[model samples]
Target: MTTFVTLTAYGLADGAVLALAALGFVLIYKATAVINFAQGEFLLVGAYTFYSSFVIFGLPVTVSVLNGVAIAVILGVAVERFVLRPLIGRSPISVIMVTIGLSAILTAIMQLIFGTEARAMPPVLPRGSIEILGATLPVQRLLVVVVAAVVLTAFTLFFRYSRHGVAMRAVADDQQAALTMGISVRRVFAMAWALAAVSALIAGVLLADITAVDPHIATFGLLVFPVVILGGLDSVPGTIVGGLTIGLIKMYTFGYLDPGLADVIPYIVLVLILLVRPYGLFGETRIERV
Candidate 1:
């Protein structure tokens, strides 16, 4: 029972990271109708930025985080302006291909700059453990969970109440209509990318704390796909729930099931979910006019 409790708690921590990363992917998709294949590259950039700030520049932890986020936001906006905007209104396939190409480019660039070797990220939070219900969990894991909750809450409120958020949503729903209504669809697209970058930075930081910072960390971003699909591509709340579900499944599979089963559980769940509800649990159903 204690083992189960421990696994559950740790699973929640893992889910928190997955949710943040997936949220970024969903945000861009919701606003721009573009699936950013480069989303993982942005996470890698953030992890590297944070590492540089702390280890090379000798900056404080908070400053390192801020620098990482700032760099990611700038990179996101720049990519939107230079790469995405030019290809706007093109075929979705074209856009997806461009993003995939960009991902390769970014990965190459990171390798040139940071090398392929993994680097350790300085601990952002104090190292400690606390016992809860006879299960021990690292304080850092708890911090990750807390931070994820705060970010999700803030994002929800921003979208629900803020003017900029409303504009972004309007654009997402109907870019042509938004433009007709004087909302700068282009600007909204940029904002969506920027916000997604911010989320990536947070996820990168949490992941770096748990695992070493490296090019491979970008793979974690790909894991977000299951969460995004399960939660519904357009549903923010669904991301949270979906992330938790994936995390729990991972834990249970690793614990009770065969170790190899852990690797395939998320994909299995994703397939089953799509089979039942193609649009996802919280995703909106589209009706074709034709």
Candidate 2:
């Protein structure tokens, strides 16, 4: 029972990371209809930026985190203004291809600048364990869960009540209508990118704690796809629930299934979900009028 509890806690932590990353994915897709193949690269960049600022420069961890997030926001805005904005109203395939190209370019640039070697992230949380219900878990893991929850909650509230947040939702729903209503669709796109960047930063930092920083960090962004799909691309709460579901599924795979099954479980689940609930558990269904 204790083992199960421990695994559940760890799974929630992992899910939190997935949920946060997927939130960004959903945001960009919702607003701009871009899949953002480079999403993971943004995360990699943020992790490396944090490493450089804190681990290498010896700056305070808090300061480094702030700087890292700032860089991510700038990168997001730049990408939208330069790369994605130019392709607006173009073919979806073209936009997707551009994102793929952008991913490769970002990866190459980072490789040249940071090199291919894995770098370590400085520990942000205290190194210790907390006991709950007779289960011992790392303090950092709990922190990850708490931080993810807080971030997700804050974003939910922002989108629910804030003016800009409402504007974003309007843009996501119908860009043309949003524009007619005096909302700046372009600015909303940029803000979506900025928010995505921040999500990547948080994911990168938390993931860096568990995995070393390297080019492969970008791959972690891919994990967001299944979560987003499960939650429904347009549903934020669905994303959170989907993330937790996938996390628990992964944990069970690691525990009961063949050790190698962990890698395949997500795809399997994704396929099943698509077959059963094409729009996702909480995703809004589209109605077309001819």
lDDT of 1 by residue, 1-290 (tens): 78898888878988998888888888899998899888888888888888889998999988888888889889989989999999976999999999999989988998999999999876887789999888888888888889999998999999999999999889889988998999998898899999999998888888888888889988877778889889999988889998888988898889998779987899888899899987888999999996
Off by over 4 Å in 2: none
> Lowest-lDDT window of 10 residues in candidate 1?
118-127
lDDT at position 63, candidate 2: 98
Model 2 clashing-pair count: 0
Estimate candidate 1's RMSD in Å. 1.2
Per-candidate local distance difference test = 0.88, 0.88
Ten consecutive residues with minimal summed lDDT in candidate 2? 118-127
- Give per-model TM-scores: 0.96, 0.96
Predicted structure 1: clash tally: 0
Clash pairs detected, candidate 2: none
Candidate 1 local accuracy as lDDT? 0.88
